[model samples]
Target: MGQPPLEAEIEIAATPDEVWAAISNVAAMKKRSPELVVMRTFGKPKVGRRSVNINRRKGFAWPTTARITRWKPPTNDGGNGSFAFYVWPTDVEWSYDLEPSSTGTRVVERRTALPDPSLSVRLTAKWALGGADNHDTELLAGMNATLAALKVEVEQP
Candidate 1:
């Protein structure tokens, strides 16, 4: 079977628009994401927009580029929305989804399953990232941490 998608979710005591505000802001996301050190977007964020990202793991750092594939901000105060990007090198898509909930909003972060990573990506994962499985485990944990941090930030007064 193929690898399962990496996912993590959290409920925040804030509206969907409020959550979208945080999720859509690439600058703010850099602060929330554990692996993301820098994310520079060209102009405003929209579908088809491009970004340069620098990710770090301990002493290892790598540069990657991505294109925004989806950008649907909440249409109304309590509407659902999603944002996604297609990342190069790994050929994976990462996304964030927001849904209105009873208490406030439910935020979900997801990374597409990587069943056939490129040879270069495979080697880099093995050498620099402590193997694919281990790195995926860390990525799941990072997703959880990122969602938890976002919850804290969005729920703040």
Candidate 2:
């Protein structure tokens, strides 16, 4: 079976459009993401756009590529909005969803590892990258950190 998606959420004291403005700058991810060392986009962030990322953990750094598959702007009323990308050279999809709330905006980050992982990818994730549970735990923490940083950025006056 495919691994369950890992997710984290945080409320930012900003509207959905404000939140989207901060998160949609995929090329600037390295500045906000705790684990992403670098990210470079080939074109504007939109469905079908490609990007490369380098992530680090415990002194180890690895590279991955991804293609944007979904890109939806927040509604004018500050309702739900989301964008997602599929990581290549592996079966992983990462996404961010935003929803307006009474306090401000709720931002959710998700990571889904495709169920039909190639043997090579599975082994790499299990052994080289730490076991599945360990990796998921780290990812959750990173997502929380990323969202917290973003909240601070968007809430600033």
Candidate 3:
């Protein structure tokens, strides 16, 4: 069987635009992610924008370059929208989608459409990052933590 997609979702007490603001800011992720140490973007979030994601675990830090592939702000009519980027080396796209809901706004984050890794990269992931299964577990856990932290931050007065 194929590997599972890494995903998580959360309902926030804010509007879609509010949630969008929080998630669109690359620098703000340091506050929302327990594993992310820093994210530096070369330009504002837009299609083709480039950024580097730096993550740490047990004192080991690694960086990955990414390019934005999709950037749709929340519509005024409360329609579905998404922000997404493709990370290099792994070639997986990470997306954050926004939608209106009864409670407030539903925010979904996912890592999907991962390209098959080359043998060397696969070995690196196994040794340094973790095996595929363990990495997916970590990604899912990180998504949940990120959404939960953003919910708390956005809900605060």
* Top-scoring candidate (lDDT): 1
Which portions of model 2 show Cα errors greater than 4 Å?
76-78
- Global lDDT of each candidate: 0.90, 0.84, 0.83
Summed backbone clashes in each candidate are 0, 1, 0
lDDT of 2 by residue, 58-107 (tens): 77788889899889989744478898999977678899999989998999
lDDT of 1 by residue, 25-140 (tens): 89888888899999899999999999999999999999999999999988743389999999998888999999989999988999998868778888889899998889999999
The number of the candidate with the highest TM-score is: 1
Q: How much is 22 displaced in model 1, in angstroms?
A: 1.0
Give candidate 2's error at residue 116 in angstroms: 3.8
Return the TM-score for each candidate structure: 0.95, 0.90, 0.91
TM-score-better candidate, 1 vs 2: 1
lDDT of 3 by residue, 2-85 (tens): 365788999999989888888888789898887789889897789999998887766567888899999998874456678998
The number of clashing residue pairs in model 1 is: 0
Against the hidden true structure, what lDDT does model 3 obtain?
A: 0.83
TM-score of 3: 0.91
